[model samples]
Target: MLTGKQKRFLRAEAHHLNPIFQVGKGGVNDALIKHIKEAIEVRELMKIRILDNCEEDKHEVAEALAKGARAELVQLIGLTVVLYKESRDNKRIELPKSK
Candidate 1:
């Protein structure tokens, strides 16, 4: 679990990033989860865009993606979802100390 401060910091850090992936009409799948898990291991922070064609609820998709990737869901604004995870080999983006 991430502390509130850590999430805020990550949100700021991800503000300028573009969505690297998109969830469309197909919705979340194992392949998507696998890719996200693999990517998060290196990038630590990323954003995913949910397109208007998607059938699932935005929140459900966000939860599924976060759970599947074993990452923290930092924020879900508009149609974008921000995710964060501690990189195992290529660690970056030092988070704020949790109180």
Candidate 2:
């Protein structure tokens, strides 16, 4: 689990990133989770865009994506979601020690 500081840092780091994946007409699915899991493993932090035609609320989609990928929802802005997950093999973005 991310501490407040870790989440803050991740949010800042993800600010300029463009969405690496788009949730389209199909919405969140097994394929989407698979791709998100892979992307998070590589990038540690990734942004996903909910396409204009997506029927679900942006945050609702973000929550589902986050849960499906076992990732943290750092921030959701407009139609975009920023998610983070520490890689077991290619680990990055170490969390700070909690007090």
Candidate 3:
């Protein structure tokens, strides 16, 4: 779980990054979750864009992706969902300490 401040910081860190993945008509799947888990482990923070044609609701998609990938749901703004997870080997981001 992330603190409010941590989420805000992550949101800012992710602002300039373009969405690295897209959820289209297929929505969230096991394959997508596997890829996301691998990518998040390397990058830590990432954005996923939900296409307008997607059948699942944006919030539902975000929740599913976060749960499936075991990553924090940093932010869901418009159609873009930001996710964060501490990397095991390629760690980079330094989140604020929770008090």
Candidate 4:
């Protein structure tokens, strides 16, 4: 879960990034989730794009991905999504301490 401030920071960090992955007509599969989880562990933050041909709504896809990967949905804009998860071992982005 992200606070508003944290989400804002992540959105800015992800703004210039291209989609590292795409959810196509097939939608979010278990295998896809596993791979995405790995990528998130490494990259910390990444962009995902929903294909124009996708029949399911964008929020549905974002929710599915978040639920599948146990990650945070930082933002959803147009067809894009930003996801984040702190790696226990490979931890990267050090968030500001919250009192």
Which window of ten consecutive residues has the lowest lDDT sum in model 4?
90-99
A best-first ranking of the candidates according to their TM-score comes to 1, 3, 4, 2
State the lDDT of candidate 4 residue by residue for 1-99, as single tens digits.
Answer: 688888888888888889989999998899889999999989888999999988898999999998888899999999999999998788778766554
Error of 4 at 81 (Å): 0.7
Off by over 4 Å in 3: none
Which lDDT values do the candidates have, in the order given? 0.95, 0.88, 0.95, 0.89
lDDT (C-alpha) at residue 12 in model 4: 86
Model 2, 1-99: lDDT tens digits are 778988888888888888989998888889889988987998989999999999888888999999999988988889989999888888867766777
Score candidate 4 by lDDT: 0.89
Question: What TM-score does candidate 1 reach?
Answer: 0.97
Better of 1 and 3 by lDDT: 3
Winner by lDDT between candidate 2 and candidate 1: 1
* lDDT (tens digit, per residue) of candidate 3 on 1-99: 899999999999999999989999999999999999999999999999999999999999999999999999999999999999999999899999988
- Local distance difference test, candidate 1: 0.95
Which model, 2 or 3, shows the larger TM-score? 3
Error of 4 at 46 (Å): 0.8
lDDT of 1 by residue, 1-99 (tens): 998888889999999999999999999999999999998898999999999999999999999999999899999999999999999899988888887
